[model samples]
Target: MEQRIQSYDALFELMPEMGAQKELLGCECAQPEYCFTHYLEPGYKEEDILVEICQSVTEKKQDSGQITFKVFLKVSKAACIFYKGSYNTLHKSYAMLLQYIEENGYEICGSIRESYIEGVWNKESEQEWLTEIQIPVGTGSLTQCIC
Candidate 1:
């Protein structure tokens, strides 16, 4: 998560350098979130989980060193789980979402998205932090925000 935060910071700093602008999705400020997928191998450790942080841009930009970009396609349906608390307990929300999906016959088809709605940047207390976990699933309700 810290690494993803660093990537978000780097992306904000490098956007202008790459001649690209952030495409906000109906938000007041730059979208503050770490949208990524973990690449797990049999020999990988918890600390070794590797992910590629992604950010939205107004348009595709030419690659300049580390400014490479890719379009993030949308998911047909997602199990949206909302949690308000500390990062340490964030796993509980994921566990809940997984259990819900399994019991509801929802298949995990794509990468999961972690959106930091409220965090240390805006909130003072860790207990006030808000996170939304979107797990791509097959046809069903468009979105389910089990807060």
Candidate 2:
């Protein structure tokens, strides 16, 4: 596993069903109880934001297969970790990538940015899913709360 820091352009993608939380909350970016994925500004923590966002929407659980809305981060100075594996074993890939990042003196600064480089459910078995685990680097705190 290899980790390299790189900058990225801001992006906004929508998730119909956020895996962690599933409820149709309206689309209000700042709602403390809404359930929509959003693009965090450059210097923010994805995990903290995700928790707050999940709270704003609701605290109810849904069926296992329910599709929930979620968001992906648009990051800069990200430590990129690329790998190929079965979906079930992808966690190992992340662990290895994190180890490599630590060995190289980088810290996980934000929510893990994931990109499916391959295996879109329409590809063959020989082609394992290629994903990039982009963890942000450099920070004073994981979050910058403007209270």
Candidate 3:
């Protein structure tokens, strides 16, 4: 089988338009416990982060006040790493992952995706939290370089 990146469309529970976590709790959502909170931020900046939750179903009907969206991620090639630690130390992992991609002849092509596998409620220790970093990449080529 070809070692190609896999991409997919997913339903995401988004933060309220105002980007308030407290408002999210007030919004009606079913079985919120099963959802894992994910963050999308530009360049790992804390202030730029947007909170979201991955949904189990793609066609889930949202309540009147619910904030959600369907998004598709295209991952043609990528460098992935599993991180186990506090969110505060993710910069270390990101640095290492970026180095790995550069050494392997791939360049980041899109926004990074951090999927929280284990977190606060499930894990007591900050060191036990699990996160997966998916950095979309693409092979360098003259065609790409020209543009």
Candidate 4:
């Protein structure tokens, strides 16, 4: 697949609000509607993790209430895989993607992004859910994985 950098303006919320679906809906945005939860920290633990909950905005919008506007950019080369199944089973798909990256001599260079393509709003079952896992890759010779 062809690699391209993507950029979007998003609304950010912290911790508890980050996972609040209702809160995200409050912000208005345009087409190809979707939401993104960016893990700002390494660990996925709930206690003190920093996450940026974002939705694509056509034009730069002002932050209101708890929502703060921020830019989300995916730079460099990227490898993506379409995952079909429950979110609980995402780890398996992620492992497969990471393995493919390593075997192909590409190193992960940034935070992993899970884009929700189809979910509860449309699909009736978790098994029918679709998510796109996008991992940014580096072109350098460094073998270290930064993801």
Best by TM-score: 4
Measured by lDDT, the strongest candidate is 4
Q: Which TM-score value belongs to model 2?
A: 0.44
Query: Cα lDDT of model 4 overall?
Result: 0.63
What does candidate 3's lDDT look like per residue over 1-147, in tens digits? Answer: 011112111222231222353344453334433243444444544343454554433343444343454445445566889899987787899899989998888876666767667866579999999988878777766444221
Higher-ranked by lDDT: 3 or 4: 4
Model 2 lDDT-worst window of ten = 1-10
Q: How many residue pairs clash in each candidate?
A: 0, 11, 0, 0
| Candidate 1 RMSD computed on C-alpha atoms after optimal superposition onto the true structure | 7.6
lDDT string for model 1 (8-97, tens) is 335334333323323222212224434433322322234534444454444564554444466566566788888999877777898899
TM-score winner, 2 or 4:
4
Worst 10 residues of 1 by lDDT: 21-30
The digit string of per-residue lDDT tens for model 2 on 20-80 reads 2243433333433223122244433423233112223333334343333344344556667
Q: In model 3, where is the ten-residue run with the lowest total lDDT?
A: 1-10
lDDT of 1 at 119: 70
**lDDT score of residue 27 within candidate 3:** 36
Clashes (candidate 3): 0
Candidate 3 structure, TM-score to reference: 0.60
**TM-scores vs. true structure, each candidate:** 0.64, 0.44, 0.60, 0.70
lDDT of each: 0.56, 0.45, 0.56, 0.63
